[model samples]
Target: MAERADAARNRQAILQAADKLLRDHEPGHISLDQVAATAGVGKGTVFRRFGSRTGLFQELLAERAARLGAAVESGPPPLGPGGPPGQRLLAFVDELALLAAQNIRLIAAHERACGADPHSDPTYQRWHRHLRGLLSELRPDADADFLAHIVLGGYNGELVRRITASGGVPRLRIAVRDLAQRVGDVD
Candidate 1:
C-alpha cells in the first residue's frame, strides 16, 4: 500500500514537471532527463511510469482533454449547459481555439509520434459531437454533422498558433466569433 502511494506521488510529480517543461520550453526540446530531474525522481522512474516521451505526452493530452470535456459538460454557461445554442457554439469554438493555441507544441508532438489525424482524436470527437448537436439546434435544415467538422477545422492548432502569434489571443477570439456568427446564421 505504501509502495503504491509512493508510485502515485511520483507519477504526479513527473506529470507536473512535464507540464511545466512543456509550457516553459518547446515540447520538441524537452527531454526525459529534464523531467526526471525537475520531478526529483530517477530517470528510470519516469520511464517506468510513462514508457516513453510519446507515452508521457499522451497522458498529458488525455488529462487536459478530460478537463476541457468536464468544463463543456458541466461548468458555467456559454461553454456549458445554460446558453443558447448559437452562443454556446461560439463559446465552444473560442475555447477550443484557445486550448489548441496554448498546447500547440505538445499536441503537435503527440500527433507526430502517433502519426494520427488530429480530427480522429477522442477530444476532437467529443467537441465535434457537441458542436453538431448545437448546430442542429441552430439550423434544423443544415447538415450539422458536416458543419461541425468545418467549424472545428478553423480551430486547428497550427492555424490558431499562427493567427494568434501575430495578433494575440484577443484577435484569435474575434476571428472565432466572426466564424461562429457566420455558421450560426441559418439564412
Candidate 2:
C-alpha cells in the first residue's frame, strides 16, 4: 500500500533531520529525541518509524547506496552493465572507495550498528552479489564467492576510513582496484 501523505512527509522530515544532525555530530551522540526535535516530530514517531538506531542508520546507508545499485543494475558501462568484467570491477571498487571516504561517519555508524553481521544487510548483499558475479565471470577457476568477500574486506567502512585518513581515497581506490584485478585475473 502507498504511504499516507502525512507519513511520507514525516519520514522525509525525520530523514532530513537525521542527515543534518549526522553531518555535525557523531552518530553515538545523536538521539531519536534529538532527531524528532530537529524534525519537529514526536519521539514516539521516530521510534515507530525507525524501530531503533541501527535501523535508522541502515536506512540511511540504503539511501546512500541506492543510486550506485541502480547504476550497477542498469545505468552505463564501467559502473553498469556494458563494460568488461575487469573494467567494471575497477569502476565498482573506485566508486565504493569514494562513497566510503565521503560518508565515513555514516559508514562508521552503520558498521558499529551492524556489529558482526553486516553480510545480512540488503545493500551489502546486493553489492556482494554483483561483485561475485563479476568475479565469477572473470575467474572461472577461482572461488568467486570467497574472493568477493575478500575484495569487500578491503572496502570495509572502518578500514576505508582509516586508510583514507592516512593515504586518501585516491590511494585507497588504486589499491582496491589493483586488488580486484589481481584476485579476478585468470591464471
Candidate 3:
C-alpha cells in the first residue's frame, strides 16, 4: 500500500527536524516532543512513525549511511569501485574518519541504537564488508576480515569524538591513511 501524501509530508518534516536538531544538540539532549514541535506534527505522529528515540535516530543514521553507500557504489574514485584497490581502501578509511569526526553525536546515537553489539548492525556490517572486499583485493595474503575490523577500531565513535574534541581530525586522517597504506603494501 502507498503512503498517504500527508503521511509522507509528516515523515519528511520529522526527518528534517531531527537533522536540524542534530546540528546543535546531541541526540540525548533532543526529544521526540521537540522533533514533533519543529516538524509541526503531533507528538503521537512522531512516536507512531519512529517507535522510540533510538528508532528516530537510527533512521537518521541509516539515511546518511545510504548516501555514503551510494557514493561507494557509483561515485568517483577513490571512494567508488572504479579506483585501484589500495587507493580506494585508503579513500574509504579516510571517509570513515571524516564521518566519525563530523558526525560524532549521530555516531553515538547509532552506537546506542545498536546496543552492545554494534558489529551486528547493518550499517557497520555494510562498511565491514566493503572494507574487507577492498582489503582482500589490496593484500590477497592478508586477513582482510580482521584487518577491516581493526581499521574500524581506530575510528571508534567515542574515540573519534575524543580525538576531534582535542582537534585531531587531521592527525586521525593521516594515521588512518598511513595504516591503510602499510597494511595494503607488501614488504
Candidate 4:
C-alpha cells in the first residue's frame, strides 16, 4: 500500500517531531499533546495518525531502529554485504552497540511500556535468526541456530547493562567482537 502525498507529509512531520522529542526528553516524559504541538498538528490529527502515545513511541523507535538496520545492511563492507563472514559478524555487534547506546533510554521505556512481546515481534526474532545464519555460514560444524540465540541473547544482556555506564558501549563492543571471534573460531 502507498501513502497519499498528504499522508506521507504528515507522517514525516510526526516522525521528525518525535525524533526531536526523543533527543530532548526521556521516553517516559513524552505525551501525545506535546507530540502534537511539536509536530504542529492538532491533537485529533495525532490520534488519527497514532492511536495512542505508546503507539507513536513504538513507531518512532521502530523507525529509528530500522534506519540503523538499513545502514548496517547497506552502508559498509563489514556491516553490509561485502566483507568476509567474521568481519561482518563483528560489525553487526558494533553497530548494534552504537545504536543501543544512542537510544538507550527510549528503548528501555518502550520495552517497558510495550511489555516486550518476546517471540512475537519479527524484529527481535529476525536479528537472532540473521545472526545464527551468519554464524552458520562461518562455521558449518556448529549448531547455527542455537549459537545465534546464545550470542544474541548475551550481547543484548550486555547492551542493556552498559547503555549508560561510563565507556560502557566501547568496552562492550570490544567484548562482543572478541566473543564473536571465539564463537567463530570454535570449528
TM-score of every model versus the real structure: 0.77, 0.92, 0.84, 0.74
In terms of TM-score, which candidate is stronger, 2 or 3?
Answer: 2
By TM-score, highest first, what's the ranking? 2, 3, 1, 4
Model 4, residue 101: distance off in Å is: 1.3
Clashing pairs in 3: none
Q: Candidates 1 and 4: which is better by lDDT? A: 1
What's every prediction's RMSD, in angstroms? Answer: 3.2, 1.8, 2.4, 3.3
Q: Write the per-residue lDDT of candidate 3 for residues 1-187, one digit (tens) a residue.
A: 9999999999999989988887878756888899999999999999999997777877887787787888899999989977888878878888888877877888876777667677876778899999899889878899999998988887777877777777678977977788788877822
Q: Is candidate 3 or candidate 4 better by lDDT?
A: 3
Q: Give the number of the best model, judged by lDDT.
A: 2
Per-residue lDDT for 1-187 in model 2, tens only? 9999999999889888988898999867888889899999999998899897778888888998988898898989978998988888888988988888888888877877888798888878888999999999998888999999999899777788788888898889988888888998832
Tell me the deviation in Å of residue 183 in model 3. Answer: 3.3
lDDT of each: 0.81, 0.87, 0.83, 0.72
Candidate 1, residues 163-185, lDDT tens digits: the string is: 88899888888887787778878
Candidate 3 achieves a global lDDT of: 0.83
Report how far residue 9 has shifted in candidate 2, in Å.
1.6
Once superposed on the true structure, which residue ranges of model 2 sit more than 4 Å away at CA?
Answer: none
TM-score of 4: 0.74
lDDT of 1 at 169: 83
